[model samples]
Target: MGAGTGPDGSSRSDEEWERFLRESMAGAADAPKEPSARARDVAKRLRMDPARGAEGWRSYTPARPKRRTGWYVAGLLALLTLLVVALAPGRTVDLFAGDDRDSAPLAGETARPTQAPPAEEAQRPTAQEPFRGSPAARWASGAAGITVPKARAVGWMSTAEVERALARSRDFLVASSLDRGVLRGERPEKAIALINPHQRDVQDLLKTAFRTPGEKSDPLLLFSRFRPSQARLVGSVVKTRGRLTYQEGERGALQVTADVTFVYPVTRADAGGGDEIVRTIIRRELVMSWDDPDKVITKPGTFSIVSYKYTMTNGGCGAPTGYFTPPFGADRRADETDREIDPYDRSGPVGGGGSGGDECARATRS
Candidate 1:
């Protein structure tokens, strides 16, 4: 028989044999011949049982579906994706979501506002007072009452004293001489020296006579000089007053005004003299007014006043005998004479005695 076939002659050999054996064992009259014990044992040992023939050995339990690893892998991939999204900057994650378990905090979320500090304040200047006045006022006032070393007194000097003073004056001038020859065509050294010795004493007298009481020691006289040609021993007097008015506006600032006047003997000597000599008198008047208590609140450093009338007499002298009029007046008549001797003009005219008469005659004759 073939390796897959049974030894029986029947085509269904294994099945027929199994049936025959069952009937023989039951003792049925129509039973077929039973398979020999040796043959049956041989079939069982060969794993060729007729009952399990045709069908091969197989698992007894129901076949299980193939386990799907793809689902688990996909779930793991989703979890990774969620983790990446949560870890990214400027992103928020929900830990309580039905599918996810992990979540992380966002970056740059707790922001706050900032502020700047305030600036410091500015400082202001302070005011101070000196013996004469405030520094600004002092400069503004110019040379009010200062005295130089060689100045003379206001009284008349004796002949001998005058000569001695003149000599000393010349020496002082020589020491302090300046070379103005190139510019003015005249050597001012000689003229300046002529009055140097008497300058200080004379300045003292002027300060006392013209400046305000507290202002008497000011430096005003430094810029002034005595005009000998206009000097005279005349009996005259002068009175003056000054007032300071401050006009404060939108900005922090001040302005000042000064007014002054004079009353004196209208001497013939003062009239014929140069306007420069007369101007000195007016300047003195103004200086006096600046220091007047009733006019200005005199202090060392704080006040400044601009002189309104920086001129001699206001107009012409009312007295006919006077040679020159006040600042605003016409010149005096040449014929009128209530003579007051000019100390500087010691030499009389060619024919008589008046200041500049001889020079006038010479010019006319020429």
Candidate 2:
């Protein structure tokens, strides 16, 4: 047996020699001449081996350029068309599809009805109601009633309401010729004893002023007319005071007190025989006492007392002039005497006396 045999019964080495001869003869016939010395030197430096050098010299053939279809452009146009359709108005987008249109009127179609004027605005009373049951109304009624009228006028009363309020007050008015003579200062003790059957001595002087027809019966007006000559008498007094006291078994509560003072000038008719009888009446103080009602007693808040003062000169009334003080702590001290504040000086804060030193003097001289 031979080492390795081909189909021709020749050795494998003999076959290989035949194949190499054929390639060498073919290459020698078609190839160009040898390179220059520089090329030879470069090829030697590159360490080219005939078998491996074929790989290094092989050329690269690029793939065919791909054809572009119009599908991508069409797809982009389609996407833009879809976006336009989605965003355009009048597309019937149902944001509130379940809403019932038949149940309510359109906002723009209906108009609102006009409102009627207030009762006060439409019809003013020929004569104002004597007392409005408010402090402002009471003050206004008092001021207007005491002033001389533009023309003679009369005020009406139901007689029922007056009697009711009087009953609550435990007082009544009685007409007496002897009592009427005494208010003009004929006999002081006798008139005082006569009309003061209820023993409300303070009210006896007031009744004398209203005894004339067409004048409203009001304590404030009565008091003002009873004293018509003093300068200090022009202002109204609002009294404020407070006390902290412990009770038997409970915690201490703040007790607040308020009173109104009215001064009237004495006319010749009010004072007979030259007696300087200026009737002064101090309204009973209204008191409000409470615990930490809002539970805000611990916080710093102010309790205030406000007063409105007006002047009556030459039978005409003046507007009210007033002031307000800001918030303060619960432990602050309040003085009733400080109510006589100066109207001119704005530098001194309220609750503190300003140029009030001459007020007493000014009042006395006027």
Candidate 3:
């Protein structure tokens, strides 16, 4: 506004002129800012976590402590002790260390080479060993094989014996009543024969949904359905294995039961060239029956699985009803039972199935 006003109120000195230009340049530029809290946290975490870093061992290793006294003498003694231990006969203790005995060796006796100790006898793994196995066959039967898994038994049975049976059973089952192995140029009767060959009931059961103990389609074919043209269990775990518990069933028949959990994660080809995993978990019991407990006890493969039941605890794409046969009704939906659930007791029976039921339900069990 003045005739000749300097920007800084008075006429600009050389120093003031330089300062003004520098201030103007600084004002025109963007403002500097401190890093956000999240960024700072990430940086701090990176400095602490070795996985987030690639430094050498020396970078993280602590520095050596100051030297201590009497170390050389102790080390020398240790070295001498080690030499003595190494040279000692058969790695055994010397009972006559200081005794002056003249029993070095006979004049003409030659030295014998030391012999290694014999290997320890192999023993069966205890229950403490992880039960690495399948749960298909032997477990479905009441028999836990010749050897009692309960300990103090004499027999050689691997933990995974049941798994082998499951794998075999799954592969031999017909895909469906109509979609028999005929697709592979095999006869229907021949396909039936492949299932058990020894047992007619089992063979009949495998051929169709018509013969299931529930009078529905065979669910064993669930895995078999993917075989041949579609997919299979290889490169995946398709077997079922779990712990078996037992109780008394109708008419003194042993209810060899399992709340066992089985997981099978299968890899199959999609429409594209890449593959995807189809994972499933089936938690149920296949109630196999045998009137003569001895037959099953002696040769368990002879046991016949009459009915299979599915609990609410199961998962996957398998249908819960209609497709599966009428199970013991023991595995009926818990909500359908007419009982009140106790809030305090987590282990209490789920109430739903009423004591008085349909006459047919009573007659079926009767």
Candidate 4:
């Protein structure tokens, strides 16, 4: 049998067989090497799907992430602004400027605190008029300035009980502050009587302060006094301005708060009639409470002092003399650089608790 011959008896050469196999299976002469023209177009369309695809079926392309530089810059600016505000020094708001209870000076208010006269008025008090250049010139005289709020029932206390408590508070303020004798180093008996006896702790402390008036236990914390030998009062009048407010306590007590500012004028005891007068400004804030008569063991008309604080400007920082010694003559030290606060500026309450704030801080004006 020949290798290229079929069983039917036809015969062919090896070359013919090889050529036939190559031509039949390889391809036609016009066939493309890569793809048909239409197939090429389909491949191009698939590649361009990223740029211009139909809605949902083509390759998905996520949008570029939004830039965060602008948001970061805004956050940083806000933080810097907050830090600047926090580091700034604090300022006090005026406490007395908007007091509606005692807005204007009462009628027939003649007495006032005194100071060295301005260029227009004589430099000394001449028995007729004393308030020369005092900032308290417009303030009311003594207890007349302490205006009590209208009493009404609060918590467990009735209207009448509230009124009584208010009256007692006003009287105590007058006795401790406005009484000439008390100011001239006399005992504040009336003020003491108002204190509830059950407040043994306060009573004991008060007694100790009065008995041993020293740097730590000075009675001046509770009452204002001036040494008679050191200085003489300029006149009979002392200017005062303040208001009283009441509220219900958490423990069913009537809490009364008093904020008052007093101005006193004095001269050196041995100075001539024409000598200059100096002033002392004292501001006191005290809270007194009256407990329910039946529920608490309290006296019928007594007050329990909750807290007391004061600020005394222009009162010399002298030794514990139990008196407000206005730096007079050569006694006033020359180093008053940090003592430029205003006495009458009732911006905030006396800062320090218990014993009033910094002593001897002189004011810009008295």
Candidate number achieving the greatest lDDT relative to the actual structure? 4
Candidate 3 similarity to native, TM-score: 0.31
Model 4 earns a TM-score of 0.63
TM-score of 1: 0.19
lDDT by residue (tens digit), candidate 2, 86-144: 89632422333332211221122011113311122221111122111211222221212
Write candidate 3's Cα lDDT for 1-366 as tens digits.
323447576655677667767988777556676898877877787788959666543357678998776898899989987887788853334344322111121121012113311222333212221111221211221112111123121122222543433332332232222232432223345334333244565555555543332324544322222333333232321333333333444444443333232333333332342333332233344443322433333234333455544322111123322121222123333213332221111122222221122201211010
Clashing residue pairs in all predictions, respectively, total: 35, 8, 11, 0
Task: Give the CA lDDT, 0 to 100, for residue 195 in model 3.
Answer: 32
User: What is the alpha-carbon lDDT for the whole of candidate 2?
Assistant: 0.27
Give the higher-TM-score candidate: 1 or 3. 3
**Per-residue C-alpha lDDT of model 1 across residues 161-187, encoded as one tens digit per residue:** 333433443233222211222111222
lDDT of each: 0.29, 0.27, 0.33, 0.72
Task: Decide which is better by lDDT, 2 or 4.
Answer: 4
The model with the greatest TM-score is 4
lDDT order, best first, reads 4, 3, 1, 2
Worst 10 residues of 1 by lDDT: 129-138
**Ten contiguous residues minimizing lDDT sum, candidate 3:** 357-366
